[model samples]
Target: MKWKANTLSLRSLLCMPLTLIMLSTSITSAVIPVKTAYGEAAVDEQQVRTARSYQATLSDWKRWAADHAYALQTIQPESWSSNGGSIGQDKFSDLDILIPLLADKRIVYLGENSHGVAEFNLVKTRLIQYMHQTLGFNIVAFESGLGDAALGQGRIKKTATPDTMRRSIFGVWWTEEAKPLFEYMKETHKSESPLRLTGFDIQVQSPLFQNANWIPSIKLKDRALQAEQEVHKWRMSKDQSGFRKAKPELIKVYEELLQAVTKNENALKMDYPDEPHIVKLMKRALEDRIRVIQEFNELCIQSNLLTEQGDYSGAQSMMEWRDRAMASNLAWLVTEVYPEENIIVWGHNGHISKAQSLISTMPKSMGELMPKELQQESYVMGLFMGEGQAAENTREPIQLNPIIPGSMEDILAAVGQPYTFMDLRYRENERGNSWMFERMIASYQVQMPMPLELRRHFDGVLLIKQAKMPTYLPDTHK
Candidate 1:
């Protein structure tokens, strides 16, 4: 395949708003320069400049950590070169440090720099295993669709295969790095305490797993699903105008489906007389299916184009709506669905941060809008990369600039561990900790250059030294 470049300077791209910049576009220069998987490729250092423009080095960060006596927890590798580790002995004994910090917590929010960073996903999978085994966190909730999760969860209940588990979650997590997590989920299904799968997003993460077709009223449900499958015929669409033209008519099908669902609500309740919760779940899922089609107009492009080309208002509304819905769905999961069970949430740094409104134009994020009681029991960890490259959705890898000096990431790197986790909770008002209170470089590689205050948002952070693109699995859905 030819290297596709969007023909824009990295500098110019960074100048754009985070909302617009995150809409994945080709950023390669087309001039070929191949590099190893785990090592940094040669990219212009000037392209990595932040607003601060500080001339600093790894030595400076080390000097700062030495001054502070900064304590760091080094995480052991589960062996990156191959999945298997020293089978008998404990490879992840380092994870014991997280126990005291998380043992008493009800929820753990794992934030990645982006959806496609393989290193983040790899460690997160281990963390999930550790948390599940040690801390009694039985549920692994993704930032996927509520309805899809509902259906996926049902499938796992029936037959928990690796494919079934992978299919239940988002495609971004469908990789060789993520294969262990999928297999683990399958393995634990027959155990006494299996990891439960769920999602909180209003958006559709997996097109393959759907549940709206199984509604109580099959005739009404099939009609809507038929219209939806018809919309998939435009999957190869290159014409934006065609989608825009048909959006209204396609939306009408869902709108009618929603109306019919509401009208027959009581009758649906009658069908599941002994199981009100199941009835409620299917009803809410039907609503989710309707809302998702409208959000993207049965297309992922619609979500990305929300902010592109003078569509700022559309983008803002969609962002606020998604965060709010995610919050509500998560709250429901904790209180209603998985009551008394601890949960681990996996999502992007933007959606998982508590200080989202403080840093961005967002009114509230999923972290902020979560019920106050549930929020009290939650701890959010913002994961970051000190160096290396990330390819969003397995596209051309964009090399990250060095960690911006005086930023949170820079300060964390000050600790000088190759892969480490630092607890930012319960620190007294002090000097070395002052970095958390300042607005800093959270995602120089992902989006939002130095826009968030760490202490105000994250309770902890997992900093990996380098990031590499994931080995994306074959397009099995195709």
Candidate 2:
């Protein structure tokens, strides 16, 4: 069989041994010459079935689009790069279709299989701009530290520099492809209605990094900070023994910090009688932050233990805990932080998909745990590539296998457009039932097969037929 020049022959990569990369690094480390995120769990080889052919003819697609109700006429060749370009006139205009589809939705999630793809960064950047200008989606919550994003947004108000954006989000996004979005965010601050940025993660290690004020006790905070530093040091050193030693110490100190904050609520209110409300919310935020550190550390310990016992899937299943905590934090942001505003969530497809997890026994995902209102008001669009080089932030780019037969990528590849979108929300047609409910390949990284029911997972899907190596920015500040 003839193979595409760009497609690599590494289908056996996943069949090799599995290794968890990092525990405390900002990005979740999967493992390899290239480890991946979107839950760094290992899968059984038998469970990872071969890609099947889902390719359909043009007429067949017409019927599917007619049933799904929309097949966006995407502009060919980097139409998403136009500056302030409007619909029907510019390349970015194809994105305007998203405005209507997302209308009346309270939250919108844009997901990526790999964070290191250049096209994903650029397209999502353009989407953020379009949504902000036309749809009034002023908030963009990333998968960064809650406090890190808060600090970054504050700096955006002050400088709005690209460096600040790099520091605020995960390390995976620190690339030239991702820089334009930060610049756009900077420009927004100068506008009448600035786009706001925040993180929906519980990964912030220090309470002091948050907007939270009136935190209790200097002694406890100092000790917790010191412990966190040690844990971070050990993690970065890749010294497992050091990490194991430092982790428990940090956990102990953090638990004390949580206890101290909980105990001081009454005292803080009494001390600051005039600012009771701010004190309460701020103090509660401190508790929330403490819980984040506690939960992450606990998950790491459990994962390490499970790995030692050879329970690889169970070790990965621990991500369900992390995602649940993140969902709770995101829900808090919606309820208490931006109750009236429309929210745009940037995260991994694994976290954003409303469908059950195909890798984990727990099955539920962050989208499933999102606010109950999200069932009716949320739209998630997953991103994928047919074939080309895909990069992970921590490693060099890898050549993805050519579009596998019977995969969602194969069906999407048949669309003929270099760039295209398919709305999965509508399923009014009875024809083409196999591709509808059939599980198909939608790998997280390196062409690894992890199939799922197409329509059940995403409201829509955006496909970039090829990926290029992302131009990496300098190492991040954090």
Candidate 3:
């Protein structure tokens, strides 16, 4: 590779794994070694996937664009940079920048994948830097609510103890890799911290006290069964001919009870002290389902992504479970909202997808969740991996099966159709192999296609790439 020759430094040559050197002879050269954000050793091109022939040709990309009814020529790449350079060529995969679709009108949501922890953190760190410096975005919301609040408070002043700091600010669920970014924000931004972090997990945890599983499913079922029994009792007490006379009154009672439960934050606190917000929200969520019973099950099936033991039925059950929680959170955000501008959501790839994403489980899209005017002004971008060439191993054998060009049907047959490609890293295949496996190879696994419906809804798309390495923002202009 061009980068390997005359680029490898003495320090890097001494530091690179002996195994990698033996696997790729071209990598043994002299150049200055660049360290990662977390001070990890820099990786060379050999570590990335070997470049592959475009599986779907540029024509195929255009056709897929046409299939989606998008104006291919109209969807131009937006201008963006680390300092002021285009992505690829000299920057590391983790340091690439994404051009914003909404410019200042909306935020660019960067996703963090759970499977690849290190890669997730690297990209996250660079993204934080870019958003803060270039975009001047202020809020950094995580898959958490309470944690964000804690971080916000902590930033104002150090109220948390050392050991308790991370827990209070990010919650127990977050991985260690994600915390450094917050710390960096706190230190760099200080009282004027541009990167504010928050978490919904914390607020939910506060109410539940124990794990959500400890809520006792049987007890919940009993409550539902009791509500049904009451209804039956009311029906039996009235005469058949007079049923219509009492029907309105009986129905009114049930509706009133549901509303009361949903609004009674104090009642929720009595039952689940730690999770009053979750309980109150859940009540409202349940009412929503009861109002739309038939469609309820279908919505659930579409919202769930990963499951331990679930088919469509299981997905529905999971959705129903999550829907209530999501609704409750939404209610809180509605009533007790903060800044409307520059809010960044950090979550897993599945949750960020416009199609059946984690956020989709909510009553509305993240953009829709905002106030109507905010909805028009706000935008969302799901950061995803590209099949470009960042995921190759030198020791492995290369396989090449370029995708059949101009065939969305074939691409989806190999992968799935109605998909939107989100290549945040612009990684291509190194082994040059491409036969549609049911799942993606780990190297090229970060592909999350936007659904056809969602792609059309966006003002524009800002695909990120890391083709270049160790270069500044201005390099892209060259």
The sequence of per-residue lDDT tens digits that candidate 2 reaches over residues 92-144 is 45564564467567799999888778888887887776677666787899987
What tens-digit string does per-residue lDDT give for candidate 3 at 191-269? 3333545443322222111222323345443444454444334322313334345445444544654655555645444
TM-score per prediction, in order, is: 0.71, 0.72, 0.41
What lDDT does candidate 3 reach at residue 229? Answer: 48
Task: For candidate 3, give the lDDT.
Answer: 0.37
User: Cα RMSD to native, each candidate?
Assistant: 16.7, 16.9, 20.5
Clashing pairs in 1: 440-450
The TM-score of candidate 2 is 0.72
Candidate with top TM-score is 2
Ordered from best to worst TM-score, the candidate numbers read 2, 1, 3
Winner by TM-score between candidate 3 and candidate 2: 2
lDDT of model 2, residue 288:
56
- Model 1: residues with Cα > 4 Å off, grouped in runs: 1-91, 157-162, 206-222, 229-280, 291-311, 444-447
lDDT minimum window of 10 residues, candidate 2: 1-10
The weakest ten consecutive residues by lDDT in model 1 span: 1-10
lDDT of each: 0.64, 0.64, 0.37
